[model samples]
Target chain A: MTATVSYVPAPDAAPRSRMLGAQTRMELRLLLRNGEQVGLTLVVPLLLEVFLNLPLLSSLGGSRRIDFVVPSVLALAVMSSAFTGLAIGTGFERKYGVLKRLGATALPRSVLLLGKTLAVLLLEVLQVGLVCTLGLALGWHPHGNPIWTALLIVLGTLAFGGLGLLIAGTLRAEVTLAAANLIWLVLLFAGGIAIALDSYPAPFADVARYLPSAALSDGLHHVLQNGGGLPLGAALTLLVWSAVALPAATRWFSWE
Target chain B: MPPQATHAILAPSRPDEAASGPALEISGLIKSYAGRRVVDGLTLTLARGEIVALLGPNGAGKTTTIEISEGFRRPDAGTVRVLGLDPLRDAAALKPQIGVMLQDGVGAYTGAKARELLDLFAAYAAHPHDTAELLELVGLSDVAGTQVKRLSGGQRQRLSLALALVGRPALVFLDEPTAGMDPQARRGTWGLISQLRADGVSVVLTTHLLDEAEQLADTIVVINHGRVVATGSPAELVRAGAEGQIRFRAPAGLRLTSLSDALHAGASASEEAPGRYLITGERSPQLLASVAAWCAAQGVFAEDLAVERRTLEDVFLEMTGAELSA
Candidate 1:
């Protein structure tokens, strides 16, 4: 028997804002409440600042350690919230079939990813603000344009979050979880610190400038420490990373 | 009054049939995992408000098949239409009208309260059920404030069910929804399912428990080795059994020669155990009575005398050549 078909398009359907906004808000709440997320985004940066301020490191830096540490730490905060958070969370969600459940919903996949990105951006803004407040309390002041700094943060998060999803979506959950967290730690220490990338020497320092953490840190520092305008070169590098990583991540993401 | 009744009375029913087409239809569904076909050449149709149970053994392709239907995975080869839209082609459009509950939903949200998670999901649709009403519907109001991590297994499953229903979906897919529930919890879920059906919501579920399928399914489709072996009403399938089983004990020294000759006329017997024998293929009442009369005449006493209707378990084992996991 032939099945009859008819089409009725809903032209007056409400805009997709409600669902997108709610998904982002819920993601933010879940991230904040998670202990590891809290530690990674909040406590880790604050502790890193304190550790960088040690007197033994004072000889290695002419500038106040807090001045140098704050910007790099902000980048760290963004990475944690964007890259590590997305990777670990998405990996677990995939492992536990959360994404598969969502896949079956009527919510668009693009909207889902967009909501998550927005949530991560919201988290980075809050983290940057909080860390900046603490830096001001410590008498550390940024000399660069705030607008340029904000742009870097947003673009940097997109790039990192895209890479995070790419890793989490393609690899086994355990492997993704382990590799993401480990990369976070390695980048934290080995990549350019409050110390200059050039000061480290040889292959390590040369490769450091290419690392995303290093790119973001270098960009933020040029703007924040030197009172400079947005660094177009660094922005372009991160943009290229974002352009490639975003598509790769979305293409590879698995619901299960 | 029950929660479902309140909603049913308040809501106006949609037209019985959509002007568009079948609520869901799939043809030539096929999927494989690591080169092994899990769901091969499966076709299914579900109308609005129909609850169909996809019954099968472990790894029998039920989950794979449903995942494809739900648009979680792309089919290797198939045409799937959900609510007149292809799930793969129009996933975004179809998702709002359907809900999915997977078998495992552990450790996703860390400290989010149950109600918070529900509200979060509910927000994903233009029309969302009231958070309180949804919680109440799933019997989760008392634990609204509880973090998901702290919820018991049954409570978590209930929360998952609530998540699936919160969108007020026209179609829902539940994978082994009652795996860890106690009897009370299982019945509660069944009650919820019945309520969903009454409200004109269609559900497709995969489960190994025959009783669940028998209780909740309007139609049951059984799959074995990635192929649909049988599909029918529980009663019709049971009625097709070739024969019934009869059990009796022979009198000491009565000897198998006489019993075999007596039952060979219309039945067959085998020593299923040392002292007990099972006579199968006994179609005539006279043969059953003759066996009983022979036992009596031989002064043999038989215990555990009981006859049972054929069950889904019997049909499943017979057709699939495999046992359903408890």
Candidate 2:
């Protein structure tokens, strides 16, 4: 070995935007590759949409049942990917020390979170496309502007994504796994996604309206089903949830 | 590996920030967990291009110290500077310059293939080593398509090492870099680390292997009870206070005051056990000649006479009061 010491120069960090794009692309690929996530994010929502539209399961009792089923199933898909899927995957990542390892890298925490958000949004786009195509095949007729539905989906994603991170970051992996699944089931049955809010008693219906899932379902229902303008109350409910949950998650989230 | 290949793989992208200052500096660092002080007033410094190994028993605060240096944990007191900038406050700037190889190889996404994981980490830097070349360098090319979780323990470790070097970092903090590796792989890693130094990259590694520290480190810091018990180069440490010894198998009771008188001052001879004699003194040709002459006069041949020098392990055990491997 030569005694001559040649100093290697220090490397600069890649552009932050490029790093973010790479991270988002990697995350989306992993999400798509995971069989269980694919089942939850894509297959489960499609099956539910099909089963709910069946003649025996149709409680609305009309040719317009697909209208109600399509919007509500879209809301459910958002929750599945943004809340349930993100929570379980992130919890395990934390348990396995992946987040702690990334914490030491040049990648900033904001970039990590943004990359995950972008990935979730991208996955939601695919889910929405699948659900809408399945709805169209089932003879569904939609109404109102699509822009309002996009707004509702975006806000609903942020609200649910924040809560998912909050649960995943604060709880143990096993606990997060159970809690996230349990919450998904409860919201699916009672939060006005599969079942209309009016089907419940008046008091329970009023309270469920504030739940993020119910708010998203109600907003999407009004816009697509009733051909209404922006549902101010439902949108505000989701906005408030995001304002509270995102900051809280940011404050309390632990990398390890 | 050829020097040219090593140079191409590890060459830095720009000149260092401060060419003359130490690569890392820590002073009066204090950290506690659950009211128990783990790092108590610890201090250390590494000159540019020097490799320093932190040697300690389990729970001796080695990991905590390194984590503090890496900006993973905030010290309760004192400060740490990497590349002349605070580790925590300047982390955004410092992270790009320093590489960290964690103890458990926990950074990569387990579901991603080995090559994909390396490529992802490489994308974080402007000038990263080629992913294919890095996999080849770490002897992981055969398993490049294997998922991270499917790789063996040593393979995962090599992958972790490749991640740390992908960014062309100026300094690297490695925690037990060769743990769980076979002897041949361990030697290969040692050579790579030496090459890192020849490229003027500074390193701070923690190891339980005493011989590893002695062989690779420019300075060895022995920590016990969250404090530095001893710090010096390997040779300086072994030669500090411990003297060499000469042992032989001979008649037990044959050693009388005659041997003591025959030898020079500050030297002593004793029969530690039956048929075994021990002598402690500064070892030299004159000392050996005197002992041989004394044995000739006493009509006793020194059978199996062996000269021994104090090793770094002996120095470590003497200071830390704990087994090196513990």
Candidate 3:
């Protein structure tokens, strides 16, 4: 066959920002479309927020049950989306060769990780908006600086998101699925989200407060429920988790 | 076949870089897995716009060699240069120029819609082919909205092919490109691959289908036991050291002594079965004429007379000592 056009021999990568944006959007779209993820990230948090506020359950002494329930549920939202949802989703993506395919593209590995983090962050924003709206409709009143709440949310996400990816990248899909759910359940009941940390015996509460989930929940509860200043102790715990987990994930994460 | 000559003829209008060197160059490539050498000191070069097929039996290191070239696996020893740049050291610069389709559905997002998946890959390139046009080219336009996991094996293979082209890559590495495809889809893919060559794209593909190698590759490399046993054009490999035979059906048990004398000294005749005769010799017009002339002299007509040249499959089996599919 005769050549119709000269070979240009020019193959340039797209701008980094464009690649990150496209990957983030694709990741978020898949996260939202998955029925189980949506239920876990959004619907379940909203349901728990309402369910725990009912008078049928024995209420802890509080100014208003809505205030306490709202903060705890917000913390729960962060954990479910950033840890459980992200873990299950990424585990299956690895199992199905999705990450292997992406490895061949021009998109950098850092960009892929950042894109998934950004997608998780975006989903958290939606979750926060919905949970806050319902809290307001239920006459919940929150105090403390909004910036503290934002900081806790962001750092909590990175900490949990990093750990989630570590599990997904290193373990089999079915194992990750089971472990993530089991961890979520264990943390929900014992990690100061569904129950106040003080309610636990002194020895148990001491260790429970160090858990990432408990740190997030307690930090949010101190700021949003008690109108307190920055909870430095809880913030430090989350910061340490993020510092350790992110690098471990970056070092050990396998594409296949 | 003088691949450089073929490259010059097919892509005469290409720029200086296209003429400067081969599209891919590998020297003394060696890779091992778990104490076993999967690819042992293999060397190959591919010219611009040439389609080279890596033909081998199972565990012959075709996939390992391709993976090293694609930069997915590191070589234990040797050098690999794709588009005149190191695949690992210069990967950021090289990845955009080379597309890859891995084996066993390793290159697609299972949860993504076909269109979305293509669009996502396209976003990684500065200038990409239109998604609709690419899908149409691969005959996957009808299933663009379907999730990748929901598509049939053939549809997924075509979608993978479409992904490899969306970036307008200069070279593409396709592993088993048509393994799960139907005959019609496979034909469409072959046409698309040929079009890629026409448009000045280099292709390196690994396949068990010897017919695919013979039908599409400009040069065929037959490898066995992690080493290249033979490398040549399809016609050249078939013609290399493989004798031609002429077979015919005639009345059995006829005296063949005179018939053998009528033909050349090197030729021999045999009747191993009832009413069947076989002639082993160099195939030529003179030999054919002698056979016809001898039959007439003996007042016997030869039925089902035909000349048979060695096929690529036969050559491959002889080289590999294993079936292609095994």
Candidate 4:
């Protein structure tokens, strides 16, 4: 308000790092403000944690139901934040020309990708804390290194987030809208987030373990339910999936 | 609010800061989709502080040419320079130096507040325009906190203009910048653009409105079939097609042969109706005076005498051909 003038910057006046930081901050605000996104990313996971832990659904996870249901719910949280929420938001952004607008700015394309990824990761943390608070109240106990569980969370995020971008970037917004939700539902039971891989038949369990969702669910289960040593299988599967999907997303993403 | 005490950025602080150079230069630009050329061998240039209006029928490739210059699309064949650098090759370097306003409400973040979005864009520039004042300048202050999705079409157009100017660009590209604005807002926007030129920001805008181009542009480029049909000032282009017209009412049976003899070269007069006459010739006060003199000598009164000059619309329709685009 002091000394009024139109305040456009000369070329090279602002540093690139600040632009990326601002983008990340704006992306975070948008993600948090959307009511549907908030419900899916945080509320759904907490509801699922409480429901699956109820004595009525006890048979789904066996004697130590709290430990089992909590991990699965955490995995679902990761899936929701990284996959469904991010995909729908980005798909609509592309459809609405938000991406094209950003593409025209001085902000780098790589920075835009990093900025959105960071925002999702940041939201996933809030999701984890809220769900864990509810999990603890429901008598859920974590047995392993919280560190190992954290690794699975990050890896799970990349794998799912990568695929989200791939779909949102390549497909039509309506198609991406339908496909993201469908994929999330399909993976919830079959890929081991809700149905533990070990509960399935032997060959099917083997195949599920190869899924990023399964690897995340099982990895978090191993680390949090069994005192953690190392989640090697989960890490490797997630690493491979992340390596492929992230690059493919980068290759296929369109601005408009 | 009407910005009763608003200090505008319309006056760029460093009006003399811009050096003498072509803000944009394009030659032999070509673009095609599915083997159909959208922009074919198009050439155009914009100099510092100048406004070039690219007028065309739909599908004339004006948008395509602008996109290529903005680095949004790659030209299949051509050379383009923005501030003397390849727009495509040096996009990162060129981006901060140019501002672009896309057509049809393309770039708004519907969920974010209008002010918040502008602030975020301001962060991208080393010296962005004052965020709040920009909203005020564009008449968006009342809706600063409102979500983009809730904005009216005219408000969105104003916001788009604000976003385009936030980067303090040396050159700006606007695709139908004032399309949805009300008459007052359009006048305000034209005032802003006029000041943008005074601040030494070169501009290239595409529009279907010939009057807008005629009033605001220093040079008007008429394009058709993916190529430049004619390029000149609005006055020059209008004059190129036909001379001004003169109309009056007199006796129905006045012999035009003597009138033709009294007129200058290439001038013709015809009776459009019972008592109405039209004359097409070189437009001058003398021509109108001569018509009056002839009327007086013939002992007839010239009623409803009016002189009308050719307008940009005439030139546009003449060059582009009058046909409805699908």
Best by DockQ: 2
- For each candidate in turn, give its C-alpha RMSD to the true structure in angstroms: 5.5, 3.0, 4.4, 4.0
Name the candidate, 2 or 4, with the larger DockQ value. 2
Q: What is the lDDT of residue A140 in candidate 3?
A: 88
Range of the 10 consecutive residues with the lowest summed lDDT in candidate 3 chain B: B1-10
Per-candidate TM-score against the hidden true structure:
0.86, 0.94, 0.92, 0.92
Candidate 2, residues A1-256: lDDT per residue as tens digits?
A: 2233233645568888988998999899899989989999999999999998876664553357888899989999999999999999999999999898888778888888999999999999999999999999998888989999999999999999999999999999999999999999999999989998888899999899899999999999999989999999999999999999999999999988
Where does model 3 exceed 4 Å of error?
A1-9, B1-19, B250-262, B270-275, B293-301
lDDT ranking, high to low: 2, 3, 4, 1
- Candidate 2 residue A74 Cα shift, in angstroms, is 0.7
Give the RMSD in angstroms, all C-alphas superposed, for model 3. Answer: 4.4
Each candidate's DockQ: 0.27, 0.51, 0.47, 0.49
Say which candidate scores most in lDDT.
2
Candidate 1 C-alpha lDDT tens digits along B1-326: 23343343322223333433666788888888899998889888877677889899999999888877777678888788877777777766667777778776532464679988887777775556667876776678899999988998888888888788776677788999987888888998898787777767778999999999999988889988888889887777777764677775543344666777777465676676676777776466776776787678777887665444567788899999999989
- Candidate 2: lDDT of A127? 100
Where in model 4 is the C-alpha error above 4 Å? A1-9, B1-20, B250-255, B272-276, B293-301, B323-326
DockQ of 4: 0.49
